[model samples]
Target: MRIHLSSVFVDDQEKALRFYTDVLGFVKKNEVPIGEHRWLTVVSPEDPDGTELLLEPDVHPAVKPYTTALVEDGIPAAAFAVDDVHAEFERLRGHGVRFTQEPLEIGPITTAVLDDTCGNLIQIVHTA
Candidate 1:
């Protein structure tokens, strides 16, 4: 079977929506109200019908510590594939996005890590 949906725990759904859409260029796919949080999801503009990335709220007690440990260890919460890691890194850096790891080539793959500003480190990757 193929992948369907994936998620990134976010401290603020609204801010994550803005960053994921306005900055990263994803488009909103679904938004349904669910009690205190909304079931929000986004899809790539290039493939709107492809996999959906859910902007899940990190309200669970274990989430904070988990995310905190990941950040402290310089681990990325999620990774997104880009056509050009260097170009994408430049574009994102121009948008004032803070990057923990600059674009580095490791064999045929290149990657860069940036903070989402919503308590998550997101990685952009490309393979040659």
Candidate 2:
């Protein structure tokens, strides 16, 4: 089966949506109300019909600790491939995005980590 969807835990849905769509330039794919929270998802502009990234709520008590540890350890919940890591990093920084790791060369790839402001660290990478 083909990969269709992946999720990144977020503390706030609205804020996460704004960051993903406004800052990162992803397009909103769907938002369906499900009980206490909504099933919100977004897709890259270049792949509007491709895999959707679900902005899952961290309602569970354990989620906060898990998310914090991951971010502090520089483990990204998800990675977005970009054309230029430096340009993308600059663009994101201009939008007030807080980055934990600056752009650095790692073997055959260049990557940077940014705080999604939603209890998660997201990675942006470009192939070298």
Candidate 3:
């Protein structure tokens, strides 16, 4: 079986687009307007045809509290794979991204958590 699409709850689509694309280097894949929000998604530049990350609107009341709790408790909403967690963390930091956890190695894997700016904490990891 193969994974397809995934989503991240975002407060603002436009701002999230800027951060995810301009800052994180993902490429825009699809965008379709629906009411006040759009069905927006992005894919890694390295794998344009791979899984797409949807930037969904967090308009539902429960989503705010749920995402807030996850952030407050240091839980990541989504984890992205990287070649080197430390290098990715440093690159993100240079772009003014706020990190909650510095790169930490545990066993053969390293991980770091950062604020997604919209309303979630995202993790970057590498496994050797």
Cα displacement (Å) at residue 44, model 3 = 0.5
Q: Any idea what lDDT model 1 has?
A: 0.96
Q: What is the C-alpha lDDT of each candidate?
A: 0.96, 0.93, 0.96
Candidate 3: tens digits of C-alpha lDDT, residues 17-70: 999999999999999999999999999999999999999999999999999999
Q: Candidate 2 has what TM-score?
A: 0.96
TM-score result, candidate 3 = 0.98
lDDT of 1 by residue, 1-128 (tens): 98889999999999999999999999999999999999999999999999999999999999999999999999999999999999999999999999999999999999999999999999999999
Rate residue 38 of model 2 by lDDT. Answer: 99
RMSD of 3: 0.7
Superior by TM-score: candidate 1 or candidate 2: 1
Backbone clashes in model 3:
0
* After superposition, candidate 2 runs with Cα above 4 Å error: none
By TM-score, the better pick of 1 and 3 is 1
lDDT per residue as tens, model 2, 70-102: 977889999999999999999999989999999
Q: Please state every model's RMSD to the true fold in angstroms.
A: 0.6, 0.9, 0.7
How many angstroms is residue 78 displaced in model 1 relative to the true structure, after the best TM-score fit?
0.9
